[model samples]
Target chain A: MKDWEKNIRIVEPYVPGEQPNFPEMIKLNTNENPYPPSPRVQKAKEELSIDILRLYPDPTSNLLVEELANYYGRKKEQVFVGVGSDDVLSVAFLTFLNSKKPILFPDITYSFYSVWADLYRIPYERPAVDENFQINKEDYYKENGGIIFANPNAPTSISVDLEFIEDILEHNQDVIVIVDEAYIDFGGISANSLIDRYENLLVVQTFSKSRSMAGMRIGFAMGNERLIKAMNDVKYSINSYTMNQPSLYLGVEAIKDEDYFRENINKIIFTRENTKNSLEKLGFDVLDSKTNFLFISHSQYKAEDIFAELRENKIFVRHFNLPRISNYLRVTVGTDAEMECFIRSIEEFLLKRA
Target chain B: MKDWEKNIRIVEPYVPGEQPNFPEMIKLNTNENPYPPSPRVQKAKEELSIDILRLYPDPTSNLLVEELANYYGRKKEQVFVGVGSDDVLSVAFLTFLNSKKPILFPDITYSFYSVWADLYRIPYERPAVDENFQINKEDYYKENGGIIFANPNAPTSISVDLEFIEDILEHNQDVIVIVDEAYIDFGGISANSLIDRYENLLVVQTFSKSRSMAGMRIGFAMGNERLIKAMNDVKYSINSYTMNQPSLYLGVEAIKDEDYFRENINKIIFTRENTKNSLEKLGFDVLDSKTNFLFISHSQYKAEDIFAELRENKIFVRHFNLPRISNYLRVTVGTDAEMECFIRSIEEFLLKRA
Candidate 1:
């Protein structure tokens, strides 16, 4: 290596799910919503003047922030928007997780938490989840720099109640507590209600899942004015114009259509329930999921084998090679027809193995 | 202060120019292109399918990156794309400016450089520009963590030739050197040609100026493969999907129309020359500008007074309150009709002052 290379900050990057583009593949690996964005989004795009491409977008993203604040019943100053939930969470980690003490999170929660910790050189500790993939509230009660975890945890598809979250937050008042609600709109309760009560609490959500606008890359966080201001300070220091003009315009439209948002979310939940029942009948132990995905494992077969078979048949799902979760597959609840195909494919593979 | 607020990382953010929205205002503060994006961009927007908004954009931004590589005559492995050049530069600072030594730049260059260093906690040194608003190549010959300066530097609107840049590169062989060429398309030459020879060099540019797409927020960097890979690793660690789908699609169309690109650039240059002559004839000292903007100071008046008077007439121009440049105003060259109005307004202000 060159001498200058010694100074380069090297990091083990977070590996996102493969975005394979086969013509007929069922893409359920990333937990993206199966439904299109609201038709108002289409109309917004149509109305967006091509002439305005010459100017910069509002650095503060007031239009989208006001809409989100109105919808979520928070003051505009209490809300912050970014390129995505990942961007919002990354900024939060940098702004809040800065003490000499190590931050804490569930060992099996969103993997990007640890990656962000490592990238910023913030010391962190991962408290192990119990055998049921549940985050123990007591585990985070100790002294730490900060705390963050997914509410409905990724790759496990299990959610803890608001009372459980409040239990942890009540213990940790001297530090910031971040509850990632990326999957909350599916079925889980959000911690947004507790933000006014707990000045240190920050609740984050995304447009990628329930709103079905992942391609536009919109996400937001709701907290007290002070926390939101500090995050905005860090975001502005990094990149002022993050949310492009089209996203600012179309995101408002996405949030305005409440009926369409409810309809698609219900569709996904309905599919999740039917898929869970079908998998249980085929001898797969499926975790109780409040999110739009199911975590399942077969008693008689290895998940790696099932994952390979599914890929060969153009059915995509997520399988982590991590400890305690290597045997499980996280399948995003797709359209009913897509889930039906996934169930049928898994059944055939199991019968052949038997 | 609350105990939780004690550990929060605080920063003084880079304040961007005002994006005022007035129907009759001549918006010349932000240096955005005074023309629309290529006609092909509109066609591409029309062709985009709203159905695809359900999926996340390609994390690598391969479509845009490949197109940039093809346009710049670099290998696909040697280019990286981000939300904007500010995003590209921030990641570069975090990736390559990690040495214990302080990095170097002109004291009055892009203000965001210092902000990024502060946000990342990297030590830096700013050598003052000479009386001519020129970077002294000898000032950068000493040891440093990194070096970055805008060619045709902002506010000053002066550029250093390739030989001067090559001289700095020769002395700073042990550190990374970044050339920010955000305005190079107007008249100045790019340092992209030296990337193959200087493996430690990173060149950043933006479409927000010449391509008339500030609203889309597209920017890219060209460097050696190892440097590009390291930046990508850091970017992935921050946000895997920085580019939205519409930007990825429309940026490709923006770059494909070389004829339109050249024509608009020539138009801006023509208007800039005319504006410079007009300002100089009015007893204002205008710097030799290779950019779409002019740095001018009146011999008989304060730039602040001129800026305020112009605002009264709904004409916006940028005036920084920083040292050495306080008397100067950075006026973006708008369309011919707008410049005529600006000149006429300035003439009236001067006549009244006399």
Candidate 2:
């Protein structure tokens, strides 16, 4: 290796869920919405002018920010948007978490947090989630530079209550607390309501899950106006045009269709409950998921083996090879028909093995 | 500001040109192409399936990379793509410019470089360009962590030759050298031809100027395999799917329509030469521009006042408020009809002052 290469900041990269491209496969690995995006979003894309591609988009994304602010009953200054939640979190890490003392997060939360901390040379400690995979309020109450974790935490899908979140925020008044609500629309209450109370709280969310626009890459954060200004300082320094023209156009459309948004969110909640019951009937211990996915482990079969068997049967789900979560499979809740096929394949494999 | 806000990193942001939304304005500010994107590109975007919005795009961006490789006669491993040239340069800053010694660049180059250095906390030094607004090769021969400057430099619009670039690369064998070729397609010979000989060279180009896809946001870097791998590591840590699906599909289509790309590029070059002659006839000392824009300063008229007068007449151009170059205006080469309007406005202003 070259000497200059050795000086490059390196980290173990975050691996997203598989994006298999073939047809006829029951794809439920990543937490993507099963329904199509809003009809208004489709119409917006169709009506865009092709000639506008010659000019750069609005760097401020003023229209999208206004729509977001209107939806939440807040002023435009309280909202921040980015290419996606990953981008929002990375910029947050760079801007807000530069203390000498270590930052704090849950040991078993979204895997990208620790990766970012390492990449940016920000020291961080991941306190353990307790026996039930819940973020311990006491674990975060101690002194730290900042605190952040996913609500309805990934791979476990359990969400702590609003009171518990407030308790931690109340104790940590000197530091910033970022609540990642990527899955909050499924069932969990949002910390967005708490932004007015805590000036240090920034609640991050994504349209990739609830709005079915993962391909468009839109996400945002809401907090005190001062905190958003700080984040925008970092964003504008790095890249002026983070969101493109069509993305801004369709993002406003996606936020405007409130009825379509509520109907599909209710549908995902319905399918998630039904799938949890089916996994339990198959002798799998399922977590109490408040998300659009089920985190389950069978009593007898190895999760890795079952993951492979399902793949052989043309189904896909997520299996994290980490220490605590190796035995559990996090399967996204697809449409009712797709999930039925996934359950039938699991039954066939388990019966033949028996 | 709150207590936690004190520790946040801040920097002066880079201000791009105006993107006013009115219909009648003759916009020539941002250096965008004067033509629409290829018809094939419009068709590719139109034919995209809205149903694919439910699934995540390929994080690797294999198809776009493949087409770029084929076009450049390089392997797929030698190319890297990102949202735009700004995003590509920022990732390069994070990946390859981490040495302890101060990086070197021309003082009056693209304004965004210093902003990135400040954002990432990379120590850098800006040696002055010569009196002709040209980069001096000997000035960059001393010890440095890295070297980066735009050929056909921004705001000055003068290009340095390939032999001069080779001289700098010959002197610095240890650190990486980035040759930003944003305006290379206009007239200058590309450093992309020298990548096979110098392992430490990285050339960056964008579709914003020549192919007219600034609104879609596509840019790529060509270099050695190891550098591309390192860039991917940092990119995956920051954001996996920086490029959306439609950009990838349309990027390939833009590459396939080589004839359209050539035709438009030639048209811009022709207009640029014509504009330079006319501005010279009007008593403005226009720089020898090899870009799609002209850098011109009048001997009598103050640029700020002229900028305002043009704005009053529904014409827009860029005038920086920075030191040493405050009297000049960087005007994008628009359609011949638009350029005629811009010339008429300037003549009207100069005659009024006379």
Model 1 per-residue lDDT tens digits across residues B5-41: 9899989866767888888999889999999999999
Off by over 4 Å in 2: none
* Residue clash pairs of candidate 2: none
- After TM-score superposition, the amount by which residue A265's alpha carbon in candidate 1 deviates from its true location, in angstroms, is 0.5
Per-residue CA lDDT of candidate 2, range A1-354, in tens? Answer: 785575566768777667886679888898899998999988988888879888898888999999999999778999999988989999999989988889999989888998899989889999998888977789888889999989989979999888999999999999999999999999999998899999999999998999999988999999999889889889988888989888899899999999999999999999999988998999999999888898999989999999999999789999989988899999999999999999999999889999
Candidate 1 residue pairs that clash: none
RMSD of each: 0.8, 1.1
lDDT of 1 by residue, A244-320 (tens): 99999999999999999999999999999999999999999999999989999999999999999999999999999
Q: List candidate 1 stretches off by more than 4 Å.
A: none
Across B55-154, the per-residue lDDT of candidate 2 in tens digits comes to 7889999999999999998889999999899999999999988888999999899999999998888999999988878787898999999999998899
Q: What TM-score, to 2 decimals, does candidate 2 have?
A: 0.99
lDDT of 2: 0.90
